[model samples]
Target: MEFKICEVLRVKRLGKKFYEIYVKYEEEPEPGTFAMVWLPDFEAIPLSFAGWTNGIARFLVKVVGPTTAALYNATKVGISKPLGRRAPIPLSTPTYVAGGVGVAPFLYMKEKWGGKILYGARTKEEIPKFIKEEIDEIATEDGSIGFKGNVVDMFFTKPKTRDVYVCGPYPMIEYFRKRAKEIGNIKAYFSTERPVKCGIGICGACTINGKLLCKEPWILMS
Candidate 1:
C-alpha cells in the first residue's frame, strides 16, 4: 500500500472522549474501506473511513491506546490510501446497525445510500454527537436514549427485511448472524472488528473464523 503524508486539517470533539478528525487527503475511497493511520513514533492503527469531500478525509477516533491517543491530538500524520475492498451494498434500502467507532464507515455509506440507522451505546453519553446527527434511532442499555436496549434488540422490535449492515464487536456480529436467520430475506453484511496490522492479507492479525479482514471484502455476506 502507498503512504501519504497528510496534515490534520481539523479536529472536533464529538462527545465525551471521542474526536472526529479531518485529514487533508484527496483519496475518495468507497464505503466500508479502512486506512492505516500512524505517526512517527506511535504504531499504525487501522481506522474506518468516515467521510471524504473537498480534498479532505474524515475519521472517528476513540482513545484506546497510545496510537489512538496520539491520533486524537495529532497535527500531522501518515495514512495509507484507503485499503480493503468496498463493502457490498445492495440497491435496496439498508439499515446500518453500529456500535461505538464502528459507526465510522457507515457515515459515508449513509450519505451515499440513505437508510435507517440504529446506533447503540452503553449509556446515553457514550453515543457520540456525530452519530446522533446522522442516525435515525438510538438505543442505550441504560435507557437514557431513544430505546432501552442493545441495538440488536432494538432492531428486532420491528424487523425490516431489508439490506442489513452490521458493524460492532464480535458478539454483536455473531449475534446478528445467529439471530437474524429468523428474519427471512434479511440480506445481512457483517464487518470484522479485529485490529488489522498489515493492510494486505499476509498478517493473520485481523482473522475472524479463518477469514482475513484486510484481504476479504470489508463486509461478509451470510
Candidate 2:
C-alpha cells in the first residue's frame, strides 16, 4: 500500500475535540472503507473514510491519543488508498446506529442515499450538532437528549425492516448482533475498532472470527 503525503485543506471543529478534516485527494471512498493515516514520526492508524466533498477528502477525527491529537493539530499528513471491503450499498434507504465517533464512517452513505440514524452518546454535549439532520433518534445515558437509553433501545422500539448499519464499541456491536435476529428480518452490518497495523491483509494483527479486518466487509456476521 502506498501512503500519499497530502496537505490538510481545512479543519472544521464539529464538537468538543471532534474535527472534520479536509485533505487534498482525488479519490472518493465507499462506506466502511478506511485510510491508513500517519504523520512523519507517528505510526499509521486506520481512520473512518468519510467522503470526498467538492473534491476534498474528509475525515471525522476525535482526539483520543497522542497520534490523534497530533492529527487534530496537523497541516500535512500521510493517507493511504482506501482500504476495507466495498460492501454492497443498500438499494433502499437504510437505518444506522452509531456511538460517538462511529458515525464518521457512514457520512458518505448518508449523503449518497438518505437514511435515518439512531445515535448514542454519553451526554448531549458529546453529540455533534452538525449531525442532527441525519439523526432520527438519539439516546444518552445521562438523558440529556431524545431517549434515555442506548441506541439498541431505539432499535428494539420497533421491528426494523430497513437494513441496519452499526458502528461503535465492541460490546455495543455484539449486543446488537445477538438481538438482531429477534428484531425481525433486518440485515445488519457493523464496523468496530480493532488493532489494525497494516491496511493490507499481510499482517494478522487485525484478525477476528478468522477474517482479516483489512479485507472483510464491516461487521458481517454469518
Candidate 3:
C-alpha cells in the first residue's frame, strides 16, 4: 500500500510509439518487478521494471491508451510499491525473445544474464533504434527488417539450445510455450500479456492460470 512519489527525470522517444521514461526513486526496484504507476489526472496502469541505474528507475512505455497518452505528457508520476519477483537465472546462456514493447523487462535482464536477443516487430520502423546494437536477430512481419517473418519463423531458422525467456502477445508466448512443451529440454518462461489493475491484487485482474501477476512469480514456466 505504500506509494512512491517520483520525479520524472526524462522521457526519450525510442521509436514511433516506444519511449524510455526515467524517474528518481527513493528505493531501487529489482529487475523483473513492476509498478502500478499513477499519472496525475489519469489512470493507474501496470508497467514492467525496465531497469534501475544511477538512482533512476526506467520504464519502457508505449502509448496505447488515454492514460498512457497522459503519462507521456507528464513530468511526474506516482509509483506504487514494486511488485513481482526476479526471474530465475538460467543455468545455460539465456535467449531473450521479445515482441514490441514487451522487450522492456529484458533490458534489465540482459545486464545480469548476457545473451542474444531475438526481437520481432511489425516493421523496421517499429523496432526501437536504441536497441539496434543489442539485437542479435530480428523478425518483422513486413520484411523491412532482419528476417522476413515473425519471431516463431526465425526461432527455428537455427537450433535454440539455451534457456528461453519471452515477453509478448499471447499467441507469440503460446508458440514458444508449445515448443518448449514439445521439446521437453528447452527451459522456457514467459511474461503474460494480461491486463493488470489494482496492483494489490484486490481487483482480481491480471490473473493467468490462477496466478496473480502483481504478486511473486510473475513469469510462468512452460
Candidate 4:
C-alpha cells in the first residue's frame, strides 16, 4: 500500500500559506482517494488526490499544523498508503462548483472528465491563473473576477446542469445541497472537510449527522 515519491513538482502558489504540491506516485492512484502522508516527528495526515499523470499523484496541501509544517520542511523522499474508497465521478456531464481549496480534487477530475467548472474565490489574487483557464465561469466575493457575488448566487443565474459536484466549506456545501434539492434534476456530490485521523474508520473524527463520513458518505441524502 506504500507509494514512493516519483517526483515533486510545484504547480503554483495558492496563497501565502498554501502550496500546490504534485507528487508522482510510483503507481497510479485513484482520484478522490486520500493518501496517509508520513512526516518526521509528527502524525500522518490524509491528503486528497489532486491529479496524476504517468505514475504520479498530486496533492494540494496547506501548512496549517505541525505535521504539515514537517512535510514542507522534509527534503528526503516519503511514502503514502491509499486509505479510503475512491469517490466515484458522476458519469453524466457535470458542472463543478468549488470554492477555495475544495477546488483541488475537481481540478484533477476536470483533466479527465472535461466538464464545466464554476470557481469562486475571495479576490482576484487568490484565484490561480492555472485554475482560471480550466473553469467555464468564475465568481469572486470582492468583484475582482468573472462575476461579483458568491458562487451560490451565480448558481441561480445559470441554467441548471444535470449533474453538479460541489466541494468547499460546510456552509457552501449546505447551501448547494439546498439548491440542488430545489432544482430536482441535478444530482450532486459533496466533499466534507472533516478531520480524518484514522483513515480506517476507527477514530470517528469524520462522522456527520450519525453516519461515518469515511464509510457511509454516499448514503447521506439531504
State the displacement of the C-alpha of residue 124, model 4, in Å, after optimal TM-score superposition. Answer: 1.9
Query: Using lDDT as the measure, which candidate wins?
Result: 1
TM-score of each: 0.95, 0.93, 0.92, 0.86
The 0-to-1 C-alpha lDDT of every candidate, in the order given, reads: 0.83, 0.81, 0.80, 0.71
Give residue 190's error in model 2 in angstroms: 1.3
Supply the TM-score for candidate 3: 0.92
Ranking by TM-score: 1, 2, 3, 4
Off by over 4 Å in 4: 1-12, 216-221
Stretches of model 3 off by over 4 angstroms after superposition: none
How well is each residue in 4-87 modelled by candidate 3, as lDDT tens digits? 788998988888777889999766777678888997677788898888887888888887988877787778889987787878
Report how far off residue 174 is in candidate 4 (Å): 1.1
Q: For candidate 2, lDDT tens digit of each residue in 29-96?
A: 77678889999888888888777776688888888888988898799999998898765678777888
For model 2, the superposed segments whose C-alpha errors exceed 4 Å read none
Q: Report residue 217 deviation for candidate 1 (angstroms).
A: 4.5
When 2 and 4 are scored with lDDT, the better candidate is 2
What tens digits encode model 1's per-residue C-alpha lDDT throughout 39-118? 98877889888888988999998878888877877889999978888888667888888888888888888888878878
Supply the TM-score for candidate 4.
0.86
